[model samples]
Target: MYIAFALVLLFIGAEGLVRGSSSLALRAGLSRLMVGLTIVAFGTSSPELVVSVEAALSNQGDISVGNVVGSNIFNIAVILGITALVCPIPVHRQVIKVDAPVALGVALLLVLLLFNQTLSRFEGVLLFSGIVAYTWMSFILARREASPASADNEDILAVTQSRHWGMDIAFILAGLAVLVVGSRLLVEHAVALAGSFGISEAVIGLTIVAAGTSMPELATSLVAAFRKQPDIAIGNIVGSNIFNVLGILGVASVISPMEAPGISALDYGVMIMFSVLLIPLLYTGRRLHRVEGGVLLALYFGYLFLLWPE
Candidate 1:
């Protein structure tokens, strides 16, 4: 019951956020794709941020790493796959050339760091700095490439329709509040339920907790797909994955230095494989088709198989 209720809040939050952020971006003369990659992406990734930070502070640093890796894997496999299944999502040119590949590189970086047996505070600083740089570069690009003329022309209609800065801010804040509450509820109840059933610890962490932290991404992407905003949908996924590695892990490591570090090599490989798989999937016909979505979903189930026995 709690899980169902949390899902409802997630949907409502995601809907409000998508409309608010997308509209705000459009009003600021930014394209939906750019807005998705920036504002929506950051907003939706907040749940992962919270989970990782808490795990780090509690000395359960492996959970921090697992949460991030697992969430990123889920974001690509389940979330993106489902979104594409709902509606074929167009791969923006910038995404193919820039964001998607950046995500791959970030995943690779995480794997390398894990193999080193520690994510030291210095390394954490480096990882955190990368996101800062990426966000700054993104803003500059958005300003230069966005079409202000569209916003100007739409302004009259927006005013007549009562869409303004105040309303956009309200939507964003309200969405954030709902997302935090929903994520917390879902994670708590899921962990409890899994424990009650004697489910494998690995399954609970990699599935329930990972999925819970990724609810915001799931919600935002699903909503974007439903609204026929393919660019925004894909952008939110790719961007959130990048933030998962660079932003969340970085912050978590800096906070606690992540001492519990035993991520399986196979698990790391799977994460990288999924990240790289996006390139070919998106490159083929320049969009994620339903068939590819099925393939991703299959790969995710395969990943779950690996975790189940471990």
Candidate 2:
């Protein structure tokens, strides 16, 4: 019952967030794609931030660190893979040149930070600053490159013009609040259930907790894809993966230094592999085709298979 309720809330929260964020972006003179990359992506990533912080506070370093690492992997492989299968997502030039490379850099940075198997408060502050800089750079670039709104953007504006700006802000806040709560319930129940099967904290955090908290991203991206907003669909995943590492982990490590002894180098390697693979897949024809999507799905499932016993 709790899991079912959590799913409902996740769906509703994701719907509200997508509607509110997309409309708000159009009104604010930001492109829908930028909106997806920044606002929608950060908003959807809130659950991850919450989960990791809570785990850090409780001194469960494995869960805290594993959650972000696993969530990033899931965002690229599972979320993007499923979204591409629904509709081949166009690769934004900015993403390939700037955003994806930034994502890879941060993943490498995380590895460096974890060299001592610990994330110090100083390291956390540095990670946090990267997110701030990244967000500022993204906005500056977005405004500088602003063009006339597309038909889709105009249509969204028209639909939302009837409503007030306050309502949009309200929807965003409410959606984020609901998403955090829903993901908490889902993760707690899921961890409990996984414990019954004798799953380790590291595995539960990497797989179940990561997937549970990422439900918002999955729902939002799928909804965006169906709504014919490919930028939002694609941007949301790339942006979320970046935010998952820089934002969520940064905040968690700041709260309490995390020691991730249980998270092996192989886990980090897999995460980097996925991040690296996206570039070539997206660079080819500048679109993620259904066949590429299947490859991603197969890789993701294969990774899961490797994680569990025979």
Q: What TM-score, computed on C-alpha atoms, does each candidate reach?
A: 0.81, 0.88
Output the lDDT of residue 86, model 2: 92
Instruction: Write down the TM-score for model 2.
Output: 0.88
RMSD of each: 4.2, 2.8
Judging by TM-score against the true structure, name the best candidate: 2
Tens digit per residue, CA lDDT, model 2, 10-76: 6677667766776777687766646655776787777778778877877778888888999999999
Query: Least lDDT summed over 10 consecutive residues: which range in candidate 1?
Result: 153-162
Best by lDDT: 2
C-alpha local distance difference test of each model = 0.75, 0.80
